[model samples]
Target: MASLEQPILISFKLCPFVQRSVITLLHKKIDFTIEYINLRKKPDWFLEISPLGKVPLLRVKEHVLFESAVINEYLDETHGERMLPEDPLARAEHRAWIEFSTSLFNAQHQLTQARREETYYKIEEDLTKKLAPLERKIGDQGFFEGDSFSLVDSAFAPFLMRSQIVADNIGVDPVSDYKKISKWRKNLLSLPEVQKSVVKDFEDLYMEGIYERGGYLADQ
Candidate 1:
């Protein structure tokens, strides 16, 4: 086994994308340091190094890497047990699903930020429409591809975590009707790596963000 290189992950406390990287690192059991920064007040050094001015930038030795997906693929390729499949076609399918997970994340953001019942329900309907395919695709196995967890699970876990938190806080479950998603969520939440992927005050911070946005759910 190649020795793992310790990396510093530059992150924001509540970023879901950053959470994905954190979960991947923790799942791989890699040694890493996390540095939180205010996105509103990014330092000159961070701005100089990050081309896209995004969180979840990985600094390994002297090399700085950006983009959560790219960083994750690099990490899986270089260290720990392989999270991606070995077959070329299977690997490509997993990559596509990983990309699809971003749409779920975006839909969740829209749903959370919606201030009106009409908008909220509309986004919810759209989200359900989006999830229908996934509900059909997901099988009896616990994780995305099967019994084993993969990069796809890491990519989608943050959205599931946040959705549950929002549902708990607002008393509305967006994913209640999706049986497969509900089951997959339970499985993901049971993992130690997924449970420990976020900051201690994650729920508090998430609710704070929702309240700050003045959404309908926040009022409820």
Candidate 2:
């Protein structure tokens, strides 16, 4: 916020991490610009500034910050009502689950990218185990922790969005059975922030990526 210029978020259209940051920015109603890039053919300027050479880089004037979680934290802390809890223990718990959501995203990626049914089902089982605790944590109010949207919700929105896309395109629903998670996902997906987080053609692009991967789900 020290800079007067609008923040620019470097992104890759298919990256869930980038989508999560976009969700946070939208939820906070932050004014920003997004620059799309090809990970396969990284621009020389992008590679030069990004230490990790990753998308979702937040450029604030001359300074650049990488990593989706860090960028969301910076945006939330500086721009609007804090999405994170004020209580130390509660905040830490949310942070832990946000980190856990990263693994869920990884497993979801593996689920979509698996070459065989066995691999896909195995990944689904692992995701079930990972999502069980979150189900208990979800309140009837619909958001991750409770009635209000938080950073935790932003972290997991991408995963839920992708899952819904897979269900629509491939007949696979990783979190279909959990009643609480199902409701939570429905509510999250309904939000304008979650809805507008990705590109307009996100569903087609995501389904196309699955088919291009030649994975078991893609065939289905």
Candidate 3:
């Protein structure tokens, strides 16, 4: 077993990217401390650790790291959890899917806010069109990588959960319509570690953004 010090994670309670780091640590059963931050108003210590000024920065002993995917890999490597496979081709494929999911999210889902039902539906339509390919890709595979959960699963889970919330808020069920993808999402969320790690306040985040977009903003 690789030795690990108690890592410190600088994160935001509502960021899906930061949530990915939390999930991986939980999956590996690694003990760590969490320092929640406000991205708009970052803390002095957080900025000192990550000058780039981003949340989800992981500090292991004297070393610091950034980016959600990179943080997950660092956690796996340091803790010897092997969340990612050693096979080069398999690892590449996993990375591909993770990047693909992030790209799709950027294209269609990132800007969703409560405007009109039609506005949310437009996002749903874009996501639905993009998801057809993923649904076919899974085609009943229990996980993204063959039969076992891997790094790709960790990277993808946060986005799927966020998407589910988006669908719920919009009153349109993307996962429900996409059979294979829906099953995959269910399996990912069902992991005990995933449940423990993913932030629970995502719906409120959505609601806050939506309300703000609607010209109604409070201390949320």
lDDT of 1 by residue, 67-135 (tens): 899999999999878999999999999899899999999988987789899998888888889888888
Off by over 4 Å in 2: 1-4
What residue pairs clash in candidate 3, if any at all?
Answer: none
Question: lDDT of each prediction vs. the true structure?
Answer: 0.89, 0.89, 0.73
Name the lDDT value of residue 120 in candidate 3: 57
lDDT of residue 76 for candidate 3: 80
Q: Write the per-residue lDDT of candidate 2 for residues 127-173, one digit (tens) a residue.
A: 98998888888787788876899999999999999988888776778
Q: Where's the lowest-lDDT run of ten residues in candidate 3?
A: 211-220
Model 1 pairs whose backbones collide? none
Q: TM-score: which candidate is best?
A: 2
CA RMSD of all predictions: 3.0, 2.2, 4.4
Candidate 3, 9-107: lDDT as tens digits: 877887777888888888888888887777888767677878678777887778888988888887888785587778898778777887787866564
| Candidate number of the best lDDT | 2
Model 2 — which ten-residue stretch has the worst lDDT? 1-10
Rank order (by TM-score, best first): 2, 1, 3
Q: Model 1: how far is 219 from its true place, Å? A: 2.6
